[model samples]
Target: MSVPPRLSMATLPSAAGAGMRAPRIDPAALDIGIVHLGIGAFHRAHQAVYTEDALAAAGESDWGICGVTQRSAHVRDQLVPQDGLYTVLQRGTGAREPRLVGSVRQVLATTEDDVVARLADPAVRVVTLTVTEKGYRLDRHGEPDLRDAGVRADLAGHAGAGHRPRTVVGTLVSALARRRAGHGRGLSLVSCDNLPGNGSVLRKLVTGFCAALPAPGGEDLAAWVAREVSFPSTVVDRMVPTTRSGDRDEIARTFGVTDAAVVVAEPFRQWVVQDDFAAGRPAWDRAGALLTADVTPYEAVKLRLLNAAHSLLAYTGALAGHETIAAAVADPELAAAAAALMVHDASPTLRPPAGLELSGYCDAVLRRFANPALGHRTLQVAADGSLKLPIRVLGTVRDRLAAGTEPTWAALAVAAWMVLLVRGRTDDDRVLAVEDPMLGHLRTQLGRLCDRPRPHDAARIVAVLLGVTEIFGDDLPAHPVFRDLLTAHVARLLTPTPRRPSRSAGS
Candidate 1:
C-alpha cells in the first residue's frame, strides 16, 4: 500500500502557495547549541516558540536546538521527514493562528549516542529538560529513589561498562562525565518542568545520584559537576493538549499540507526563569520571557493557584460528567468551585510577586480554562495523580492548615479523587482507568475498603487514603482539623443529592 505524502522541505514552496507560513530563518543554516530532553508537545509549543522568537530578535543562527526524545521516537518520526520543522496552531476564541517553528535543527532518540555527544559538546552551552515530575525518579521526601532499578544500575557504573543510561539523572551524569573527561567548559541546565524550585531539586538529585555511584572517580566527578554545571529553575505555562487524529486532519484541510508534527495549544502562555547561567545563554528575555533573580514568587503562585486549581477541576469535572476543561468550567457549579479553590484555598497560601493581583490572576486562569478551542481534557490532566497531588494540591492544603485555615476547597478536591476511585468510572459513564504509577497499590488498598459492607463509607475511605504516606505523607492524617474537614467533604461527596423542584410545580 502507498503511504500518503506529508509536508516536507521539498513541498514547502507548494504549501506556502496555499497560504501556509514558513519559518523566516533557514533551518539548514542554523547550528545546534542547546540540547533539549523530552521533546513533547509542551516543549514544542512553549520553549521552542520562545527560542525561535529569541533567535529572530537577535538575528543569530547558532542557538538552534537538538531535541532528544526520552522514551519513544514518536516526535522524531514526525519531525525528521520534515527536516526538523513543525507547525504551532494557537487556538483562541477569535481564530486559529498557525505558524511554522524552526528552532529545532535536529532530533534524536534517547538511546542514540548523539544525545550524550551533544551534551558533551563544548559549543553546547545550555541543556533544557521537560521530562515531567516522575522523570526525576524522586521518592516521597523529594530525594532520588536509590531503589529504582535504573538508578541502581546507573549507580553501579553501568555507563562505564558500555551500557546506555536508563534514567534522566543517569543520562545527565554520563553526559557530564564525558564532558569532564574532555575538559569541556561549564554549561547551564535549565529545568522547565512544573515542579517548584526545579533547578535546585535537579541539582540535588544529580549530585546524590553521583554520590551513590560505585565507580572510581565518582567523588571527583561529583565535585567537578558541582563546580561546572548550573541548574536554573523555571516556571512554564501553556495549555497544549495531546494532539489527536482530528487535529492532523484539520491541519491538512486548513494548510493544504499534511503536517505530521503539528502541535495545537491555547493562546495563553507564560515563562518565568531565574536569570542564572554558568555560561552565556540565549536572550530569552528579548522574546518576552520573564527573567528574574528570584523566580520563587512566580513559581509559588503558578503551582499553588493555577496548578492546584487545575487538579481540583480535573477530578471534580470528571466526576461531574465534563470531558474538556472548557466544558467543565462552563458548568456554573464547577466553575464556582474552581474559583473558590483558587481564591480561598490556594491564594492565601501564596505570597505572590509584588503588584501581582491574586484576584485578576484567578480570573485569568478561569478564562484560560474555558478556551473551547484548546479541547484540554480533564482525564489528561487528571492522570498521574500520585505524582501530581503532592505539588499541586497537598502543598496548598498543608499551608492552609498551618495557617489555621479550614481548607474546605482543598478537602473537596481530595474527596473528589477518592470518589472517582471508588466509582471506577467518570460521571460521563466512561471507564476511569486511573493512569498513575501506583495504580496497583491504589487498587489493592481501595479494594480492601470496597470489599467491606459499607464500601462507599466516606470516613473509612478518607482515613485509608490519607494514611498512605506515599501520597498524603505522615503529618496530614495526624492533624485533626484537616482529617475532620476531609471526612466531612468526602461524606458530602458520597451522599446523593435531592432533585430540584420543577418551575411548573411552583407555578
Candidate 2:
C-alpha cells in the first residue's frame, strides 16, 4: 500500500481549498500545558475538539496538549507527519462537516523518555486520560493488581532500570515520581473513561502502586501525590467510530489534503466534569463542558441508560443480522427492544441529575444511535464483553432486582451475548471472532459445555456462563430471580424457529 502524502504545517497556507477547515489559532504560538494519555479516535473527536474550542474561546495559547499514546505507535505514526494537526469529520444525516483541531502541540509514544519529562514539567498543570477500562490494570476488586507482571516490575523499581513502563498504572507512577523529584508542582489528573468513579478509582490504583513500591522515598511520593494531585472524574459522551482507510481516503479527496489522523464522529458531544481540579484548568465550560460540583448523577444516567442500551443493541443487533448501529436500531423490533431496555430495565435504577428528563434522554440516545452517517459498527461495540458487561448491563440487573423489579430486557441482552458466544456467528451468518481479554478462557469454558451430553440445553449453557465469576459476580449466579429469568431468555433464544422463505422462492 502506498503512503498518502503528508499533511504538515508547511502545506497549511496553500491547503485551504473548498474542503479544508483550517484552525483559527496559530499552532506555533501555543504552549504545552496539558498532557493527554491515549491519543485515540475518541479523544480526538471528543476532548481534543473541546480543548481546541476552549482555547479559542479563552483566547489563550498556554493550554496546548501533549498527546501520549500508551501502548502503540499507531497514533504517533499518523499524527507526527501531520504536525499534530488533524481533521474531525462530523457526520450526521446531512453532509459531513470537517474541522481542523490544533490543540495537540506534540505527540509522543510511551517509549520516549520525553514522556516522563513532559509529565513532570511545571508548565503541564493537568493530565487527562482516555485509557479504556482494562488500561487501569485493576483487579476484579478494583485495586491495583500488583500480581500483574508489569505492575510488579514497576513497583520493584525496574522503571529506573532503563526499561519503559509497561502499564498505564506503572507509567503514571513513574511520571509522578519524576514530578516529585523535580518541581513537585501540583497537577490535576482527570479520567474521561466510562468507568464509575473513574477519578477515585485511578487515585486508589496510583496510591496503591506507590504504597507497594520497594524503592526509597515511596511513602513520601504517595504523601505528595495525596496532597498535590487531584483526580477529577468526568463523563464524556460521543460516538467516534474507529477510522477506516476509506475515511482517510474520503478526507484526502474532499479536503485536497492527506490527513492520516482524520477521525469521524457524530455531531453530538458532551462533557460533565467534577469541579475538583487542584490546579487551574482550561475554560472547558466556555466550550459547553458542564463543570459540576458532582458528576455522579450525570455519570449514572449515561452509564446505566445510554451505555447499557448501546451494549444491548450491540449484542442483540449483531445477532439480529444488522451490521451498523443505525441499521440495527432501524429495525422496529430491535429499536423497540432497546427502548424497553432503557425505559423499563435501566431507567428505574438511575438517579439522573436534577431537571434532567429521563424519557427525553432516552429518546435522544436512540436518535444518536440511529444516525446512519456515523457508521458505528456493531462488532466494534460488541467486543470486550467480559470487561463491559459488569458495568454496563449487570449493574442495572442487580439494582433492578434489589428494587423488586424484573430486568427482563437486561437479561435478554446478557442471554444474547451467551448465544453469540455459542453460535460464533450473527443471525445473518456473519462470523464473529471473540475479542475479549478472556477470549481464551471463555472458549475453554464454552468448549467444556459443548462436551456435555445436552450441549444445546439453555439451562446448562446459562449456568456455565454465569459461573464465570469474573464477568458475573458469585452472588448474581445464586440469585434465583436473576438466574431463572436469564435462563428463560437464553432458552427462548436457543429454541429453533422456522426459517423464512428465500426471496427467489416460487420464481
Candidate 3:
C-alpha cells in the first residue's frame, strides 16, 4: 500500500477529496498583506478562517497571510511543504466538510529577515498575533518586563545592522523603527491574545519598549509610535483541539491527501475586534466578525463565564481522571460546579454585554465544551495556569472581592490548579503532567513537598503559590478569606478519591 501525495496546488486538483472545498481565490496570485505572529493551531482554525471568508465575500485577495512561527520552525515545516494549504475540519453541528484554507500564502521562521521586511512593508498594513500570554514577556503589572535579559539584550542589539532581536516585542519595535524610516505609513498592530484590554496592553508594551531606548532616540520613537500605530484589542472565541495522528490518518484515507497541518475545530467561531485601525483592515465584519468601538463588554462576558469556567473544568476534570472536556463537564458534580461558577460567581462580576442573555450564554458555553467530537483535552486547557488563570478567572475574583464577597467557585478553580501543581497526580494515581512557565518557581517555593505529596501541607501550598505576586498580586495572598478558601479546597482536592466508573469522551 502506497501513501497519497502531500496536499498542495498540484495534488489538490487531482486528489479525490470527498466534499472538499478549496479557497475561492487563486492563492498564488494573492499578494501578502497581513503578517501573523505565533502561527499556532488556534490562529489557523479561527482568524485564518475569518480572513478567507472576508477575502471570498469581498472578492479581494490582498489580505493573504504570511505566518511567522515565533517559538520554532515546526509550523513553517508543516505549512511550507504543502504551499500553505491545510485542511480545517469543523467537527460539530452544521459543520461544512473539510476545506483547504489558502489564506496563509507563506510561512516563515522568526529568524528569517523576511518577517522584519514584511512588517516594514507598506503593502502590509496589519500585524496580528495569537502568541499565547507568556509571549508578551510581561511583568506582574501587565507591563513589559525590562528586567528580562532577553528584553535588555534585544533593546541593545536592535540598533545594529542585520540584528534579529530574540523577543516578540523586540522584533515589533525594531520593525516599527524601520517602518518609520521607510514608509512613514500608519499600521494596525492587533493583539488577538486572551487579555483584557489587550490592545492597550500591547500599546503599553510597544511604547514602554520605545521609552527603554536610550534618550533622544527613545523619545523620538515614542512620538512616532503615538502617531503611526493602532493597537486594537480583540475577543476571539473558538475551541480547536490538538490534532491527533488518527485525525491526519483519517484525512489521508477520506480526502486522499497527506496533510501535516490539519486542524479540528468546533463549528462555532467568533471574533469581536476593537475598531481602531490606523490603516484599513479586512472586511471581517462581512464574515460574522464584530468590528466595534469597544470590545470590553464582549471580552468580559467571554472571559468570566466561558474562559473562567473552562479553567475550573480543566483542573477539576483532569484531577477526576477525565481525559476530555466533554467527559469533565458530563460529571454531575463538575457540571453543577461549572454552572454555579458561571452564573453565581463570574456573571455577577461582569457588566453584561448587550443582547447577550446571561443564562443562555452560560448554557451555550457548557454545550460547546460538551462537544465530544471536538475532544478538547482537560490537560490541554489546564496548561499554563500561571498565565491563563490571571486573564480568565482572577479578574472575576478581584471584582467579587471588590463587591465585598468571597469568590468560592473561583477559589475552588484556583485551588484545583494549586493541587495540580503541588500534588502532581490524578485521584486514581495517574501522573498528570504539569506544564506551566512558572513550574520552576512553583517547585522552588513548594520545596520538598513536590516529592512527597500531602493534604496537610495545603495551608503552606496556598500561602506560597499566592505569594508569587505575578499571578495573584499582594492583595489576594493577604486576603484572609481568599487564603482560607484556597487552603480548604486544596486540602480537599489533595485527599485520596475512590475510583469511579469510567466515562468515555462521548459520554
Candidate 4:
C-alpha cells in the first residue's frame, strides 16, 4: 500500500471526479467575512456545508469562514495542512457522493492573537459558534459562571490587564471590546449550539460577563454590545457522529486522497435561524436554511421533540449496552420509549412550528436516529446529561406536570441517566462512559446506592438525585407525583431483568 496524496487546494481539482462534488466556488476569490469559533466536525459537517452551498447558490464571495479551533490544535493542524479543505461523506444517501468543501479559507488557534484580530476586523460581520453546552460556563440560570476558573482568568485579562483571555465568553467579551475600539461596526453573533433560547442566553451571558467586569469599563462595553450586537437563536439538526478512521479510509479509497478532517454525516440536515442579524449576512435560506423572525417556536419544537428523544435513547441505550443510537432505536422497548417521549410527553408541551405536522416530525426524528451509517454513540449523546436534560427533557417534564399529567417517558429518561450515574455499566458488564460536569455532585448524592444495595433503596436514591436543585430546581422535588414516578422508574431500571416500560399513572 502506498501513501495517498494529501487533500489540498492544489490537489482539490483532481480529488473531485466520480462519486464526488468539487468546490463549486473558487476558494481564492472569497473573503473572510465570517469567523467561526469552534471548527470541530459538527461545524464542518453542518454550518460550513451550509455556507458553502449558500456561496454557490447565491454567488456570494464575501462570507468565507476563518475557522478557529477552541480546544486543541488538532483541527487547526489537519485543516491548515490541507489548506482548509475537507471532505463531507454524506452517508445514508445511497448515492455516496462526498463533497469537498472549500468555504473555510483558513484556520486559527484560540491562543493566536490573530483570532482577536480577526474578530475585530470590520469585514467580519458575523461570528458563529458551535461550542457545546459546557463551553458556555453557564450557571443553572443560564448566566455566566463568574467563579469559573476560565471565566475568572479571562476576566482578569480583560481590557489589557496582562492576561490572555481564556474562556469563550471572556474571549468574546475581550474581542468585542477591541471591536468597540476599532471599526465600531454592528455584528451578528449566531449561536449554532443546541442551547435553549441560545440567542437570548448568549446575550445574558455577555451582559453577565460585562457586569462582572471592573466597574465603568464593563458598563461602557455592555452598553455598546447592547446597541451594536445581535445574538440570534437557531435550531440546528444534523446527525454527525465522530469521524472514525474507517470514514477516512473510505474517503481515501473513493476520492483517492487523504483527508484527516473528513466529516461523516447523515443526509438529513435542517437549520432554522432567527433573521435578526446586526449586519449583512449570508443567504442561508437559499441553501435550505429556514431564516425567520422568531426561532422560539422552532427551537421549542426541536428541543422537546428531537433532542428530548435523543437524550432519552442515549441513556437507556448505554444502559442496555447498545453502542450506537441506531442500535438503541432497534430495541423494541427503547424505541417505544423514545417515540413516547416525543409523541406522548414532549409534543403536548410544544406548538408545532408553522407548517410542521407533529406526527410526521416525530416519525422523521426517530427515522433519523435509526440510520446505522451515522454511528452516533450513545455515550457521546449521554455525556453532559446535567446540561442537556434541562434543555431537552426537563422542560417537557415541567410542562406535563403542570398540565396535570404524568410525564412517564421523560421521567424514565431521567431515571436512565441516574441509573447510568450510579451503576456506570450495563447488565452485560460493558462500561458505560457517561461524562458530566456535575458528575461528582451526582455521585456524592447517589453514593447511598453503595450503602444500601437492597432493592427497596430506590426511594432514597431518587430523593438525593432529585434534590439536585441545579438540575431539578426547587419545584420538581416537591411534587409527590413526579417523585413517585421517578422512584418507580429507577427501581425497575435497577433490576437485572430489563422489561418494557409500563405507562405512567396518568396521561
- Report per-prediction Cα RMSD to one decimal: 3.7, 3.2, 1.3, 3.7
Residue runs of model 4 more than 4 Å from their true location after superposition: 93-96, 448-454, 498-507
**Cα lDDT, model 4, residue 148:** 87
Query: On TM-score, who's better, 1 or 3?
Result: 3
**Ten-residue stretch with the least lDDT total in model 1:** 498-507
User: How does candidate 3 score on lDDT?
Assistant: 0.89
Pairs with backbone N, CA or C atoms under 3 Å apart (clashes), candidate 4: none
Question: What is the C-alpha lDDT profile of model 2 across 283-367, one tens digit per residue?
Answer: 9999999999899999988988899889888887777667788877887777898899999998888887889999999999999
Model 3 spans with C-alpha error above 4 angstroms? 16-18
Model 4 TM-score? 0.96
> What is the Å distance of residue 482 in model 4 from its true position?
0.9
Per residue, candidate 4 scores C-alpha lDDT tens digits across 1-507 of 997899998778778764568887899899999999999999998999999899999999999999988988889999998999999888774535788899999899987645777888899999999999998999888888866889877887787755667788887898899999887887999899999889899999999999988899999999999999999889998889999999999888877889999998988889999999999899899999998898889889888988989999999988887888888898888899999999999888888766889989999888888888778888889999998988898989998999999999999999889888887887565666679998887787777584434448779888898899988999999999889999999888777774433221110
lDDT of 3 at 282: 93
Q: Looking at candidate 2, what is the lDDT of residue 474?
A: 78
TM-score of 3: 0.98
- Candidate 3 on 1-507: residue-level lDDT in tens? 889889998888755346578776678888998999999999999999999999989989789999999988999999998999998988887788888888999898986545788788899999999889889998987667988888988888877887887898998998899988887987999999888899999999999889888999888988999988999999999999999998899889987899999999999999999989998999999999999999999999998899999999999999998999999999999999999999999988878777889999999999998889988899999999999998898988898888989999999999999988887788888899889998988899889877767789889888889999889887898888889999999988888778796475887
lDDT of 4 at 140: 83
For model 1, the local distance difference test gives: 0.83
TM-score of each: 0.94, 0.94, 0.98, 0.96
